[model samples]
Target: MERELPKQVFIDGCEQISMEFEPIGFRFAKSGPHASRRAGDWAFKISFQSNYLNVGGEYVELVVHASVYSKAIKEWDERSAWPASASDWVAGGQLGNLRTPHHWRTWNIVNPHTRQAEIANIVANIQTTVLPLFERFDVPRKLAEQVACSQVPGFMFPENAVRFVLWQLGPEAAENCLSYWVARLPSPDAFRSERDVPTLPDRLALGSDTNNLARVARAMKIGLSL
Candidate 1:
């Protein structure tokens, strides 16, 4: 009897999961462990991660991730050379993190006998948790709103968020978004001590003397000053 390669087992598992995902507009890549769907200028993706060591044996541990991307936002950010944090996708996190009262979750596929149940659990999480979240931000404007409010996961900085709003909504929405963050800035006196200075993420989001936020605003032609 020929022993099955672990990679083949993983691919077979993905194929089973693909059947559930395909009807919902997601297309699983050939011989790949991810599926993606396109909606106008945006793309939604679900990717799987597993330990490399498991590839040599029947045991595999998997973590699933869901993410969204915007072609418009990517183009605008690239054209302006804006310093949005590096990420292939615009929004989303691990499937577990996005769940209510969030807790990390992983699947262990120990053998063929147990694989069906594990696959079912993973598919159910995507259907119940991931799909609804993706549906909520189906349009560009809705996604921009979430990004502007910093409610979207994976968009870590307000500067990037506001820029995304600016591109998708307009200068007024961008200005409104910037105003909220600008209002949260600490007074100059508060930064007299090194420890008092806000951290890098905060400073970038809130516009420090380095003026990253202001630079983005100018790049986008928004009139707000830091």
Candidate 2:
């Protein structure tokens, strides 16, 4: 009744990307098995919560694989071991012994049809999972508005099924959030919105869609009181 997992999946996207995409690729807080795959059916799921947000979603049936001709990295390796062997920095020829990288890992999100509805759903899931987390982290409302405005691209399916996406926010978005906001580093003002706020779902369909990243940035800037 179900297909088996593919031998492997390939990610397609910018080879060297920023950290803005971590929210979509790696799980932040919530933890569970990565998406499952089968032979006839191509399905995957990612569940992670930024200290600021939590997201969970699934693609029912799609053609999941690494990019055919793109330079992107899949979540796992040929052996399915994350944090690829080469991923580790070689400082002084030592492994796992070096300053942490600047940003989180990246992945290219792949879908079957690359349809607006599908992209909308993925973005919606991101918004559903992340907005509240950002709210929780006191990310400026304005910055959030900006991000929401340009979350998805207008095009066909990416070469890879679910490769990395850029996670690096513009300087404006990171200013009030992290000291070295390029990565997951904490923000001096990150906790400003620690107070009660809307649930992830409520925040997903919030505003008229134009005020998301901007409002989020603003909220983070002044430490909006949720």
Candidate 3:
């Protein structure tokens, strides 16, 4: 069995490659006493060359639970190999599994021409036909920035999944966007008609089947009752 390496070991190992990282604070289901602050749990972020990822050229944000570091050492016997698999590494989990989480919401883009035109043309259609309408949807202007950044002559995504990856947003960016949505949406009274309705489920992580979502629980705990 491999011995678990401490946090310092992990940080030092990453330092060799110039990977920058810091601990992350987590917000639980937002209910009861745990609602106000995410003081208990911790996360870490690592930045690497965009080409290292399956989705190249775009900056990738890797978020990992602190617990994973210890688990990784035990599993792989190397502090540098913190995430065990490529998929897990990209998806904010262990290194092996790279499955996209369901909580991530998406906007689908459809086009008639498949391969006759270049990717530039396809992206252009996405920008002209889909972007304006997406702007009207509950998603905010800042969140739309990611799609805008990727709209280039040869831009291509690894897959046709609708939503962009949350991890793709730098941790700071993700926090900023999430805070903006929580502050803006939820109360229908804030806006005039349902046309401008803010549906937070589209923005935040998905909730349980009952609609008794972690966000709702946290809201209640924080006294931001809806």
Candidate 4:
């Protein structure tokens, strides 16, 4: 029997996993190694990662990444002149990272003999771990709240969190979110000096300094006294 190329093996594994998720509204991308489901303006995606071992390897190690995106967040991102695409996800991390006792998780696909177990494991993780998190924030408002309150590292930054809340909720909620972030700071005077924070190009700077936050609020046409 001809040995399967690593890419083919990975692709086949992805296909199997996608099929498992299809009943839950996920559609596997025909051209990429990801599957996604759209819920209203939000999109949840599960993508496969693998370090393609040299050409003739029989085994591949795969990591699963899950992400969530929304039209509101994408629009906010575009205002910064950041390139926004259909896949402009605002929050997510590796599937394992979201689980308790967090640690990286990978599946090793050796061949047809071992592929079923690996695929089953990946599907189980998505169903039990990833989907519940995605379902918790099925709408833009819920997701914005999660980001603003927790500021999950791989999920989002405080700066973007404020913007997302502003878009999904309103300036009032945004201000409250900003205040929450400010209260978390070790020093109330953390944002006192504009000079302490270097000016960064709009596209490259997503800083949470007072000056930047105020600018972001003003850019959105809201009066923020920070």
19: Cα error in model 1, Å: 1.3
Q: Whole-model Cα lDDT per candidate? A: 0.67, 0.25, 0.26, 0.68
Which pairs, if any, clash in model 4?
Answer: none
Over 90-198, each residue of candidate 1 has an lDDT whose tens digit, in order, gives 6677888775546678887756777899999989988887888788775668877766655455444556567667777888888777665555546422222322233
Question: For model 4, where is the 10-residue window of minimal lDDT?
Answer: 195-204
Question: Worst 10-residue stretch by lDDT in candidate 1?
Answer: 188-197
Off by more than 4 A, model 1:
1-4, 55-58, 84-88, 100-103, 153-160, 175-226
Winner on lDDT (1 vs 4) = 4
Per-residue lDDT tens digits for candidate 2, residues 50-75, read 12121212222222111011112222
Choose 2 or 3, whichever is better by lDDT.
Answer: 3
Ranking by lDDT: 4, 1, 3, 2
Q: Write the per-residue lDDT of candidate 4 for residues 1-226, one digit (tens) a residue.
A: 7777887778878888999989889999857789999877788899988885634445587889988777866666656432222235666789887765568998887667777987898898888888877776755577667666665544434556676677677777777777777666555465434323345322215455555544454444443455
